[model samples]
Structure formats: C-alpha cells, structure tokens
Target: MTNISNAKIAILATNGFEKSELFEPRKQLMEAGAKVTIISLESGSIKSWDQKDWGESIGVDMIVDNASESDFDALVLPGGQMNPDILRAEDKAVDFVKAFFDAGKPIAAICHAPWLLIEADLVQDRNVTGYKSIKTDLINAGARFEDSEVVVDNGLITSRHPGDLDAFSAKIIEEVKEGIHKRMQKAA
Candidate 1:
C-alpha cells in the first residue's frame, strides 16, 4: 500500500457480469481499505456469469441513475461478454462511465468492460488492453491495443482477464492515491 484508505471506488455492473471479474477486484480493493460501492443498472442484486453457468448475485449499492463520478474517487468496470454489452446500450450506464473518464478520474476496466469505454469514445487514441475477444473492437474504436496483464494510460487502467485481477486491483489503488490525471481531449 499506497494508503488508499480514503479512496472511494465505484464498481459499475449489471446482470451477467463475470463472477470473478467483479468479486476479485472488489475483494482486493476492500482488503486494501478502500471504500468500494457496487453500482448497477437496477436497485436489486445482479447475477453473475460464473464460468459456464449462472453464478451468485452481488447486491447493488446504487443504480447508475443515482450514482455520479463526483461521488467516488475512482471507477471499476468488470467484464463478462453480456455485462458490458448490456450496459453499453443503456444511456445512463454509458453516461456514468463517460462522466468518470471526462473528469479524468481513475477508471479500471477489465475484459469486455472496455466496450463501455468504446461506446463513450474514451478509448480512442488511449493505450488499453482487454480480453482477447474485445481487442479487435478496441482497435476498431481507435485504442492503441496491447496484450498485457495491465495497461495504465493516464488514470485509465485495463487488464486482460480475471487472472490479472491482482495487478488490476493494485493499479486502481495506486491510481486512486495518485489522484486525478490530466487527460487530453481526444477528438471524437
């Protein structure tokens, strides 16, 4: 630790999120003494996609409509194929993501979660990494793609998969402690 005890992190997700992708980072961040809030598309708990089948559910702390980038020090986006796919379609969810990026707040997106970044046009010209399946989509959206455990561009953190959760969570903590970054206004 970087002493992120005062950092408040918002995890944005919805039904069908990858089980470990969401749980691992949240667990690690919480252990690191950061306040982590689970924000979702609805008020109730959201189910997870555990490996090949449906997994457990995690309670939602606040709906995307009620949460704001200003309320937290950073943002985390966990990916399952369906999670980001569904969230990217919701204007409120997408706007929530965009607001964090627009303010230069620390954001961590693992696996397919980068889809939300693409939808918000935040990945354009930014260095990023994600699950293999989304690499093409990221490149198509103008992100400088890399195949790695973690990639940190300014305050934007990205990783390949659940296996990289340790590095992913660590980056989020480190970035949150470093505070806001000065982001260039990438042309949309």
Candidate 2:
C-alpha cells in the first residue's frame, strides 16, 4: 500500500455524484492514511446518485468558494451525469479546478468527472479516459482518449467507470505519493 500519511486530499463534488466513485476512492485513500475532505458548491450535505436512483448523502467539508488549492495535496472529481454537468456550469467550481491544475497538483477524475477537466481546459494533448458518453468531449479537448480501466497522464488520473474503481484508487494513491508532475508544472 502507498503511504500518504501526510497528504491532504480534496474531493470536489455536488448532488448527483456517482456514489461509488466518490466513496470508494475516499475510503481507500483514508485507509492509506490520507486526510480526505469533501469540498462542494455548498455547505451541509450533498446527495449521491446510485444506479437509477438517489443514494446516500455525504457531508461537505468545505465549499468550493472557500477552498484553496494550497490547503490540499491533491484533488478528486467524482462523476455522475448530473454531477459534472452541474459543476461544469458553476464558474467557481470550474475555477477551483483550474487552480489545482495551475498549482500542478495531482487530480483524479473518474467517469463523467472529466467534464470538469474539460471545463478547466486542462485536457489538451494529455492522455485520459472516462465514461463513453464523454469520449468525444475529451477528444475535442485535445486529450488522447483511451478505453481502459485507468489512465495516468502526468499527475492526472482518469478511469472509465465504477468498475475501474480499484485501479483508479490505486493510481490516485500512487500519484499523490509521487507528488507534483513536471508536465503539470510546465502546463501551469
């Protein structure tokens, strides 16, 4: 297991986030000793989307508007059709994502969460993967899209869907342990 005992991770999501995508990674990271915080568009709790219905509610640790990239070592974006679609439209949320990229911090986006990367304009020329529905959007954003369980490009890690959670969580732990990437620094 990768040890990240000193690392601080920020999970950005809102209502409609894929339940497993957010929970699994958060669970694994915490188990590995990382301090994980849920950052969202609002205070209080955000509901999850599980399969065809609403899932459990996850408490928000901090609002996006109040979050600072410097406060966390890495970022995680959980996907669900509604989650990313809604986040992509929030200017503060988009800017919050951009700040993480600008600081060259490691970012992990699973499934539809790549939409936020596209919104932040950080996918150009990078290799990434996401749920099938956003393949074109990722390609148009200049990302070399792949159909894989997980793809780690620089400090950005992405995966296809919930089934890829194991690989996705592993890669996130690996990257966070590796720290900032040179590619991200150059892009920043």
Candidate 3:
C-alpha cells in the first residue's frame, strides 16, 4: 500500500482540464491516504474535457490567490489543451506553480499541462516529457525532452499523454512516498 498519509497534495487546474488526468490521480492519491486539494483560479467548480465531450466537475478547495506552498507537500498539474493554456495566462496561477518548484517540492505534470512549468521557467535544465506537440517547446525552455510513458527527474515527474495515466500516477505516488522517506531520514 502507498504510505503518504501525511502528504498533502495540491492539484492545479481550471476549466478545460483533461478529465481523467485530474480525476484519476486525485482518486488514487486520496486512496493512498494523501490529502488532496484542488486549487484553481476561482472557487465553486471547474469543468473538464473528456475524450470527445465535457467531463466531470471538480470542486475548487481554494483559489490561487489564497493558496500557500507551505500548506501542501506536492503539486500536480493536469493537462488539457485549454486548461494549461488558460492557466498560464493568469499571473497568480503561474506564480503558484513557481512557488511550489521554488520550495523544491515534488511536482507531477502530464500532457499539455507542462505549459505552466514552461511559464514558471521551472523546466530549465530538467528532463521531462509531455504531449508530442509540446515537446519542442519544453526543449526550447531547457528541458531535456524524452519520449516515454513516464519520466521522473529528481522530484519532477512527467508523462506523455492521458494514455500514460497508469505509469504517471504510479511514478508520482512513488516519488511522493520516497520524498517522505528522505525527509524522515533527514530528520532522524
């Protein structure tokens, strides 16, 4: 079983988020005993984009302006064409992502979601993976792009597409647990 019970994760997304990317990871993380919070641009609910139709509605636990990096243990960015596209346009959301990286916390970004990482300038000199189309942009931003189901560099975890959910979620969970173990060892 997963052992991240004390881990608190922040999932950043907004309207147009890929349906499964947000839901699947949230479900798995919660099941693993991690406390997950959905942080978005606004309160209320955010919509999602399923394969060909509109998907589920996820509640926002807190707005970007009110969120603090100290409250969470990790960050998860879910991708959909419009989701990250819209989020990158918001200065607060962009800064939120930047803060998480600045804190040296584990981050998981999949699909087109890595756009925020690019916007936050956190992709520099790191190895990552994302949708095929954005691979060029990530490379240009100083990320060593790789074509893989899942790529974990340090504490940054990334995946190619929605099809890689299994690998992506697994890697994120492992990294989170590993991070906890490392932190505990340091404290010891």
Candidate 4:
C-alpha cells in the first residue's frame, strides 16, 4: 500500500453543503496525513447547511473553473439539498466532476452529492448509494442504487448520509493510496 501522507485530495462544495458531511471526512483525511483542498464555485468561503439552519463557513482553496483533476489524487463531493442542487446546475462544476471521473480518479460522494454525479452523467451503469430521497433519481439516471453505509464500484465511492462519513472518508484515503484506478470505458 502507498502512504497517505503523499496523497492530495480535493473536496468540492459550495453554499449549503452538509456541515458534518464535509467537515468530518475532511478532518479524517487530514488527520490521516493527506493534503486536502476545498474547491468551490468561488474563491472566498462557502456556507454550510447544518441540520436546519445555515452553519459554518470554510475558506475555498480553489475555484471549480480553475481546478483540474490532474492536480489532486482524488475528489470528494459533500451533500446537502442546496449544495448539490446548485452545483449540478453549473456547467463548470459538472464538467469538473466529469473530468475526474473520466480520468478514473477516486471520487467519494455522500448523501445528496450524488446529484452532481448524475449531472455529470457518471452514475449510469454504476453501483451507488446516496441519501434516501435521491434513490429514485439514481435509478432513473442508470445506476444500481444500494441502501448501504457505503458502496464502491471501481474508484467511485458513495454513501447514504452523514452517518456514513467514516466509511466514505476511509474509502477515499484507501483509493488514493492505491493511485488512479485502471478503469476503462467510453466517455460519458
């Protein structure tokens, strides 16, 4: 196995991201010695959605339009109703997710974050799990949805909710240590 200290991971998000979904995994990954960058729609900070109200804000490390899949070892997408909903609508955000997928880089998406995967058309023919509310959407988008703490197909890792953050974050670190998955397929 490779060392996690050398890994560089990216967490993509925006306003309304689930506070715990983003913070927990980030904290775990960082504690494990990986370099994590928070990518967002803008350069400043992005607000998070906790349970019912707006939560904390995290500084953005790089804007989506300026980030490339090649710069990081893996990608993470945190979920919240508005975060993925808003990101999925942005061409730049969708393209960025698609690029990482095309490159076969490790990607861990949790809860509503799978919406971004669907927007990038990366869930088709894949096994995934996300927040219960988006299960039908995953099925409609051509994915075999699994109700589990975590589901990983190739390098794509997904989990249902914040409760699965431990598995989600661990899988991301493991995948990165293994390097890019040798997954081959037609473009999305």
Candidate 5:
C-alpha cells in the first residue's frame, strides 16, 4: 500500500452519498495514514444512502464554503444518485471542486460523483468512468468514457461504482503519494 502519511485528503460530499463509496475510501485512506477530512455543504452530520435505505450519519469536518484547495493534497468525491445531483447544483460545491483542479491536486471520484466534475467543466479531453447511468452525460461533456473499474487520467481517478472501491481507494492513495501530475499542472 502507498503511504500518504503526510497528505491531507478531503472527501467532499453531502446527504444521500452512497454509503460504501464514501466510507470505504475514507477508511482505506485513513488506514494508510492519510489525514482524511469530510468536507460537506453543512456543519452538522450528513446521512449516507446504503444500497436500498438510509445509512449512517458521518460528521462533517469542514464546510465547503470554508475549504481551500491549498490546504489539501487531494480530494475524493463519493457518489450516490442524489449526492452528486445535489452537489452539482450548488455553486459553492462546484467552485470548490474547480479549485482542486486549478491547483493540480489529485482527485478521486466514483459513480455519479463525476457529475460534479462535469459541472466544474473539468472533464473535457479527459478519460474517466462513472456509474453506467451517467455514461452518456460524461461522454457528452467531452470525457473519453470508459467502463472499467478504475480509470486514471493525469491526477483524476474515477471508478464506476461502489464495487470498485478497493481499486478506487488504492489509486487515490497512489496518486496522492505521487503528488501532482504534469498534465494537471499544465491545465492549472
């Protein structure tokens, strides 16, 4: 496993996030010694959406309105049908995501989370993958869509669904450890 002991990673999400997609990656990153912070739209706890029902509530460590990309080494976007949908519509959320890209920070997203990437206008000319339901949306946004478990383009890591959590987490850790990517730096 990659050691990201000094990396400050931010997991940005809101209520209705896919339970496994959020928790699993956070768990794995923390286990690998990375400092993982849950940055949400609010200050209180946010509920998770399990497979078919509401899941646990995770405390928000920071508010997106107050977060700065300079303070984090990487970002993780967990997906659920409602989570990304809600986040994509929030100007603050979309701007926060764009800052990470602007700074060339590594970003890992799964399932519908890429919707925010689309909202931030960061997917153009990039190779990415997400939940099958959003495949067309991704392609329409100019992203080279893939159906693989995990697709890494520059510093952007994307996966199809919760089932790809292992690979997603691993790639995030690896990318974070590798630091900034040249492509991302150029874009920035």
Candidate 6:
C-alpha cells in the first residue's frame, strides 16, 4: 500500500450538506494524512446541515468549474436533500464527476449525494446504494441499486445515510490508498 500522507481528496457539496457526512469524513481523511479540498458551486463558503440545525461553515477551496479531475486522488459527495439536488443542476459538478469515472479515480458518495452520480450518468450499469428514497431513481437511471451500509464496486464506493459515516470514511481512505498504489504500480 502507498503511504496516505499528503494524498489529496476533493469533496463536492454545497448548502445543506449533511454536516456530519461532510465534516466527519473530512476530519478522518485529513487525520489519515490526506489533504481535503472542499469544492463548491460558489467560491466563498458553504453551509452544512447538522442534526438539529445548520452546522459549521466550510470554505470553498475552488469552484467546481475551475477544478480539474487530475488535480485530486478521489472525489467525495456528502448528501443532504438540498445539497445533491442543487449539485445535480450544476454542469461543472456533473462533468467533474464524469471526469473521475472516465479517469478511473475512486469516488465515494453517501446519502442523497448519489443523485449527482445519476446526473453525471456514471450510475449506468454501476452497482450502488444510496438513501432509501432514491432507489427508484437510481434504478431508472440504470444502476443496480443495493440495500447496504456500504457498497464498493470497482472504484465507486457508496453508503446509505449519515449514520454510515464510520463505514463511509473508512472505505474512502482505503480506496485512496489503493488508488495511489495502483497508480504507482502503473508508473513503475
């Protein structure tokens, strides 16, 4: 396995992102030695949804239109009803997601965040799991939806809800480590 120190990971979300879903994983990834970048539709700050009320403000490292998929090791999408709903409408966000898929980079999406994956059309033929409500949407979009806490297919990893944060964070780190290892092997 490659050392995770300094590995770069990008998170895509906006207002109403599940506070824990975004912040918790971000904390874990950073603690594990990965640099986390929060990219959003706007370039200032994004609000989050805590359990009872709005949560912390996260700075926007880059605008979605300005971020290149080649600049990071993997992509993360934190789910909240409004977050993914808005993200799916942003062309840059969809394209960025497509870039990760086309480049074979790992992507971890949790809760309602998979809506962006469907918008990017990456769900077609991919096995995924998401918030229970979106299962039909995923199925209609050609994804093989599963009911699970965490589902990893190829480089795509997904989780069901905010409660799955533990599993979600662990899987993203593992994928990032594995991704770097595979890239190093190819370069060697």
Off by over 4 Å in 6: 1-3, 180-188
lDDT of 5 at 51: 92
Tens-digit lDDT track of model 4 for 144-183: 9999999999999999998888888888888887777777
Worst 10 residues of 4 by lDDT: 179-188
Each model's lDDT: 0.92, 0.93, 0.89, 0.91, 0.93, 0.88
Q: Tell me which of candidates 2 and 3 scores higher on TM-score.
A: 2
Pairs of residues at least 3 apart in sequence or in different chains that clash in candidate 4? none
Residue-by-residue lDDT tens digits, candidate 3, 1-188: 57679889999999999999999999889888899999999899999999888999989999999999889988999999999999999999999887777677888999999999899887877889999999999999989999999998778899989899988888888988776322111122
RMSD of 5: 1.7
Which residue pairs clash in candidate 5? none
C-alpha positional error of residue 174 in candidate 6 after TM-score superposition, expressed in Å: 1.0
Q: For model 1, give the RMSD to the true fold.
A: 1.0
Best-performing candidate as measured by lDDT: 2
Over all chains combined, what TM-score does candidate 5 have?
0.96
Query: Which portions of model 3 miss their true places by more than 4 Å?
Result: 180-188
lDDT of 1 by residue, 1-188 (tens): 55678679999999999999999988888888899999987898999999999999999999988898999999999999999999999999989988998888998999999999999889888899999998999999999999999999999999999999889988988898899899999555
RMSD versus native structure for model 2:
1.5
* TM-score for each model: 0.97, 0.96, 0.93, 0.96, 0.96, 0.92
lDDT of 2 by residue, 1-188 (tens): 77889899999999999999999999999999999999999899999999999999999999998899999999999999999999999999999888888787899999999999999988998999999999999999899999999998889999999999999999999999888776633344
Residue-level lDDT of model 6, residues 24-112, one tens digit each, is 99988988889999999989999998877888898999998889989999999999888999999988889999888778899999999
Q: For this target, which candidate reaches the highest TM-score against the unseen true structure?
A: 1
* Candidate 5 structure quality by residue, lDDT tens digits, 105-186: 8989899999999999989999999999999999999999999999999899999998899999999998898897766432
Better of 1 and 6 by TM-score: 1
In Å, residue 116's CA in model 3 sits off its true spot by 0.5
